[model samples]
Target chain A: MLVTCLPDVAKDVGANRILKTRAGHFHHPFGDPSRPEASERRWRLEATKKALEVLTEPVTEPTVFEY
Target chain B: MPTNKKIRVVHYVNQFFAGVGGEEKGDHPLTFREGPVGPGLLLQRLLGAEGEVAGTLFCGDNAYAADPGAEAAALDHIERLAPDLLVAGPAFNAGRYGLACARLCLAVKAGGKTAAVTGMYPENPGVSACRRQVHIVPTGDTAGGMGEALPKIVRLGLKLARGEELGPAQEEGYLPRGVRYNAFAEVPAAQRAVDMVLKKVRGEPFTSEFTFLGFDRVAPPAPLKGLKGKKIAVVTEAGMVPPGNPDRIPGSRASTHHWNKYSFGGRTELPKGSFICIHGGFNTVFVNEDPDRMLALDALKQLEREGVFEKLHEEFLSTCGNGGPVHVMKQVGQAMAKEARAAGVEGVVLPAT
Candidate 1:
């Protein structure tokens, strides 16, 4: 479960498609990737967490992406 | 007067109250043996001179909730001899027990006995579900309130037997079972609202004049014929680990939050030192120490490599054991499905919470 704080990385992964939500607990919509910010990472993390729970394998590790 | 033949009320209770095992007992369904057992004795003791529990029925919550066909068959086994009224555990807050009571009371009342069915309650969701059909009187939260509750319920039953016009719930001190009548009051909503406001302003007590709610239990589809070699994915509401502990996957719907995920890739086998938990909105605390124990990633990875199913999907979905809201959960589910589909995964195996 790669907890990407950015949409670019999350969207890049064919697996993180489930984390595509614009809303947060505070009832705020997360801006799209073009307008990326730190909070979007939380949403991406939330999505990643949920998606990863259903995975049948442990994520070996997350490699830092320069992009 | 031909003296009294006491009203025989049948009591139903789950395994816990019956002094049987808890969840384990509720796993079986509908069997009948004559005499009373379980909470039946306590109920009979409470009824004293007014009523006698004719019989008792016991079943597991899992069997009923998981398999209603078995539940119905079990009920058939219990209703061998009709009593004046059928009683199920007030259930307090136990969802399955409360539901069983509500359902039994409803079925008994419907079986053509003008019998005054009653259930004790402490606001189990089932109270709302079966309140309208049966005399599901409200009560305090535990068995401690049973004594005080019994007489009141019995009184309601007597009124039904005597054909006496029953007063409003508050007037009679019985829990409002939410039963409605056919007679329509002539007052319009405007007038009624005004009257209600006046009473409230005067600090006068008032009762809700109407109550009827819907209850639908959707049956689950049958399980796949055989799972001997299926590529099963175990999901739980158990918060696998502490928050921000690197976002481990979820385990239970009713459990708590924890983080426990670790990275995975070309591992041929799971590294030791990780565990899983059973969370049913009960408690949370497992993933804080390490991700390997829960998140079950290591297990899945090993299984995938071993050809557990065919190909293991990458990136499991997760959340706090708390009911992940529908909107976000569905989005996450769709994402997982997409991933699983890509990896050629099949049906999932949701661990029992």
Candidate 2:
């Protein structure tokens, strides 16, 4: 599974399936480790949970995880 | 040949070759000695009068991974020693050790000194990590090949130290770093391609001057329909493990065959305090504050309660993905895939960093 902030990483790494998250590829999203407000954290969490949907979709090409 | 200026060489090795214990002593910190210790002696003998083993620097495999400052510390020592050439590892198949050697070579090169490392496989993670920065000679899979590997490493080190023009990897017996140079060839490219195609058509041996790396294309399986009763799992290369990481998994560049499985059974939610991020690739403060950032464990548990899936797999697979060797990462994925399939896991959420 791809967890890159850059879409091209998924394309280059040959990951047939990809998950684009709001968070940075390394450390916290945008490199901000300070806990965001509860709502922001929830948004990030929900976005991550959407990975399950990516697994079930049938696609011949690369697809993104949209929550 | 009349002038008597011997090449001063600095050698690097893991704690194991420094006469320290094996994996048990991998936590030993960086240290330096006056001259050739352990394998350095072999290198010294081979250098004869032409080169001198100026110094030997060593570090523990696990220590290097655990300490964030290890690289800077090592660079400091090497810079102070200021040898003409730096040599690292005939590390064989030891994944962590091989990677350390490669990184050291890269560090040495960054300081404007030529460095070389040797290891067993062309695919060793260290080779891929620092190939662009250093020359890596291929060796056998075990330390038993030291006799053969050392001479080759010495030969390459001497050449690099002398600023001699080196040939391509194939001719030099080193792993190719996927770099190319423009040079006048004996034949034109169009003619070479035609000859190559002709040879291929005739089923004869042929060689391509350009080397391209191909990755496996795995089509996504049909998405799970109705998540209510399907078994799902969370896998990560983000290096999240139980507090203190009982498995002793290195934070980054996880050694070959060192993936850890954490039990998630009987827990509806993971306590933030109970888990920590050990991945050396990123800042861990936020992940430690909220494990869900990396694992989405809380969300997965909530989904389970909401009947999004039948059951979360009792175990979560984890390994450090940061700068890990390609082959070792492939092996980990393959081994885990087989295990997940056997466990009847229909879907996996791989959180990568």
Cα shift from native, residue B277, model 2 (Å): 35
Give candidate 1 misplaced runs (Cα > 4 Å): A1-67, B1-3, B114-116, B120-122, B161-164, B173-353
> What DockQ was computed for model 2?
0.27
In the range B18-67, model 2's lDDT, one tens digit per residue, is 99888888989898899899999999999999899989888899888778
Worst 10 residues of 2 chain B by lDDT: B114-123
Global local distance difference test of model 1: 0.51
Local lDDT at B7 for model 1: 69
Candidate 2: chain B TM-score equals 0.62
